[model samples]
Target: MPELKLAIDAMGGDNGPSVVIEALINSLKQDTTTQFVVVGDEAILSSLFSQFELSDHPQVTLVHAEQVVEMTDKPGATMRQKPQSSMRVALDMHAHGEVDGVVSGGNTGALMAQAYFILKPIPGVLRPALMAALPNMTGGRSYLLDLGANPSCDSETLFQFGVMGSVAARVLESDKNVSVALLNMGEEELKGNDEVRNAAQLLGQSEHVNYIGFIEGNHLFSGRADVIVCDGFVGNIALKSCEGLATLIIDELKASLTSHWLYSWFFKFLQKRTKKSWQRLKPDHYNGASLIGLRGVVVKSHGSANATAFESAISHAIKEASHRLPEKIQDRVESVLLEQH
Candidate 1:
């Protein structure tokens, strides 16, 4: 296998370059075949390298970027004003083929805008969708797409999401027989608005996709479908709701367990089991979300991610780059579009 080189937006996250550098060092320890091009303030990054005694490391390189895109910056304005920002520089490297992929814990809107402008969408793809992996009830995972990318989408766009998501599931899950479904209010064919109903018809007609029809929100984690398709509006809400619910459950459990010692031994046992279960479902473990439909690979890390979370994001990018996920998605999209015509 060839060495996988990734461009990192070192100053994009809340913790700044320190977290990015630490994550890179940790990732390098586990994967020697990977190389990094850290984009940020050269002086600061260099000082950190010296402090970590990694100044002589063969696999890491530093690239200087003049500006940093803040999380609150407007996407369009940032793109125009901060062309030399670390986020833009990392993306530019991917566009120029200097890196296999780009990983960033930056403003989602700005990153998505820069990616679309620089890399552009794959041929026949109308728009790129943000795809994330969610742990399912079956101890496996499912791919959900269009998560806050485009708040609104047409029937054709939803169909395209299904194709891209199915390809993603195949690569990430290593399962060719992936079943797909559209997120709707009800499971009936006629439940959702015209957009979803139309998309369902298209998916059902797709010979290449195993379209399983409509799935309600309650079935998202049931593992009933490998791919769940929705517009960004609904997908984003669903994603955030799940995160909020998880936090509430964990906090409540902790309070309840420590409140009384009447069942101390049993509470301790339950706590241990609960902790293990929560670890498996931690957002940090699945921190990277792919901007699918782009010409090259791009993974978005959570803006507030820590070292462990950022490392997981980097690993996700490496996997997608190594697997050539964009190309796979492109092929699937073209085939599906051809069938539609």
Candidate 2:
């Protein structure tokens, strides 16, 4: 049977070992063949496992760590001071080839910093990007790249994001003729600041990218573009805005539904249908973001992820590991780099 070894940061995330433990148990239940190395305080994990009556999970292995990296602490100091941190331990396991892939709900900056420094770029990859698949009402999803990697990038960077995002879309969604668009203030050729204009020009010249011109913020869910490329600063803002808006909308709807006596009775049935329809909109539904262009697959999950979210992240990491996506991405990106030589 094909096997996948996953290193999970058990001490990370807001819920700590409870969520991580549950996620591991849940994932193992679905795929008994998969194995996990829980990198965190072994005592805490063991206690949680026993408390949850999950001692029968044979696929799990415990790896000990003495410290936990708090979300607020400086990543550099934590990396040096606490070498046994769950995040560091998990990354180290992947770096040493002890594990096929790693999943973490730890600090984003810290995880990225450690992974990039330790693993480095995949030979010729200039920069690594973060890509996420967003839910759309049109039954098709859209991909956003550089969601929080590079804060400010140039035209070449944006063009590269196009290629990277396009490749991911093809692999994840099977969209061959994927349309790439630059996130801009307007759809016109002459629009926005100099950065947008420059990126537009560069994307226009890319033969590898099916450049579909500029995309405004509102166009994110329009299903008109397959891949949207922008610097991390802009992309992060957009991602956060979407998340905040979705949360606000969901909360308001729930509040309004249960506000009255008659509505409260009907709310239960309505909620079931509403939740089913809005399942894809939840951030936790797709918690893992692929760290593209790396030599190895690194999946970043939300720091506040719960058990279900962590489970989803692990599944995602396993998929990347099974396919050797990082290797394929490296080969493709290196080929492009070599052509420039």
Candidate 3:
């Protein structure tokens, strides 16, 4: 396989370069073929290098960046003012073809802003959507899109999300016949608002996507749809809610299991089973959200992600880069739009 070069914004996450470096160390253990350009403060990254004993690693290169984009900064204004920030520099490397992809555990809004400004949208795409691979029932995964990237979307934008999402599902799941659905209150044809209903009509008419009408919130993890399309506002709430609920359930189960002694062996077995199940539902396992419809690959990791979660985000970027996902999405979008015209 060809080696992939990725740029990392090491200073963006909550734990700063430490978590990024730790994740890099773990990632390198699994795949030594991948090279990384670590962008952050040279002094801090150097300290981490010594701490992690990767001072002479051939696959890692340090690029000094003077500024860091804070999580609280305004996306549009910050991207304009902080051109040389770690996050922006990493994205610049990918935009300039120095790296195959860029990964950053940074402010989602800033990341999206910078990506759109630098890479631009793929041909014929109106806007890029943030997409994440969520674990679904039947032990499969579903692709959910526009996770807080564009909070308000029109009918045409929603239709475009369906197109982009279908292409994404095909690439990620390796299933040409991917099922696409609009997230709404009910499955009735006239249930949702005008935007959703209009988008659903377009999706149903298009041969490019396997439109499955409407899917309720409960159906998100049911494996009934391979791709779920919605505006960023709804998608963000749904995703965060799922993450919170999953964490709460796991914690409650652990507490209950430890509080009992009569069923100690049974509790142990249940604990193990619950742990496995929770692992499947964990947010960290699905850490990367792709900013699809761009000319280059840019993956957004959760700002508070730990080493394991950060590594998962890196892996997601690698997969998207390896497959030339943006180009595929562009092609699909163009095809769908041409049919509409």
Candidate 4:
């Protein structure tokens, strides 16, 4: 097996290196073969090391990064002005072939902007979009594209999302017929305005995409569609709304059930048995979203991701990198573009 080196941004998330370090430890504890290059200020990492005990395993390395880019800073400005920032440092490692993959729990916009500019996309891909897996009860999970990449996309972009998403679906589940659908207000042809109509036509005629026709908001979680395509504006709303509803449900159950004496006692018992399972189901645990179409794997995690989330993100990146998803995506996109030509 070729040695895989991962560059992680230690100071990108809300909890800074604390959670990121915790996550790295979690992953490293499980497997010693995986090596990590954590990029951040040397002093802060040194201080935190004394607090948390890293195993005697010597696979982890720390790369000194003097600058830190906040989530609020402009991507272009930060890249040009603060070249040595944590985000830039990690990306530079990948650009210069020092690392095979990069992962960050940081500003989504800046991550996307910096990656697109620095790493660039595969040969045939026009744009890079975000791909996330939504938990589904019936099957393993469903993929939704353009999660937060472009607020507004054209018909061509929508078609591209379908192709990308379908490719992901195939990679995730072999022999499973991947169904693609355009997210819209209604299933009818005349439902949405011009954008929906044009996108629908493009998807409907796509040879690369499964192109199952239009799907409404309600069908997203119904497990009817394996790959859902939409603009980032709509996709972001759907993703956030899904997370919000899941959180609300969990909160309401805890609040209402714990109030009663009998229920409270049972809840305590249940918590002891099911706490780990419940925590695993939380949306934050799966923080990373692969910025699809890049020549290399670039995973973006939530800004507020915790240690467990960061670990999961890193593991996910390793899985994707090992699979060489970028190369697979290149083949699929190039084939589709050739047929178009």
Residue-wise C-alpha lDDT for candidate 1, range 152-207, written one tens digit per residue? 99999999999888888788876568999999999977798999999999898889
Candidate 1: residue 286 Cα off by (Å)? 1.4
Candidate 3 C-alpha lDDT tens digits along 157-272: 99999999888778777655889999999999989899998998888889888888899999989989999999999999998998798789868876776776855667887768
lDDT of each: 0.91, 0.81, 0.89, 0.82
Best by TM-score: 1
RMSD of 1: 1.8
Residue 196, model 1: lDDT of: 98
Q: Which of candidates 2 and 3 reaches a greater TM-score?
A: 3
Better of 1 and 3 by lDDT: 1
Each candidate's number of clashing pairs is: 0, 0, 0, 0
Candidate 4 C-alpha error for residue 107, in Å: 1.5
Per-residue CA lDDT of model 2 for 231-317, tens digit only, reads 899999998987798789879977897899788878887768789676777777778888887767788888888888888888878
Worst 10 residues of 4 by lDDT: 48-57
> Could you report the Cα RMSD, in angstroms, for every candidate shown?
1.8, 2.1, 2.0, 2.5
Worst 10 contiguous positions by lDDT, candidate 1: 257-266
Which runs of model 4 end up more than 4 angstroms from their true locations? 49-56, 172-177, 270-280
Q: TM-score ranking from best to worst?
A: 1, 3, 2, 4
TM-score of 4: 0.90
In model 2, where is the ten-residue run with the lowest total lDDT? 332-341
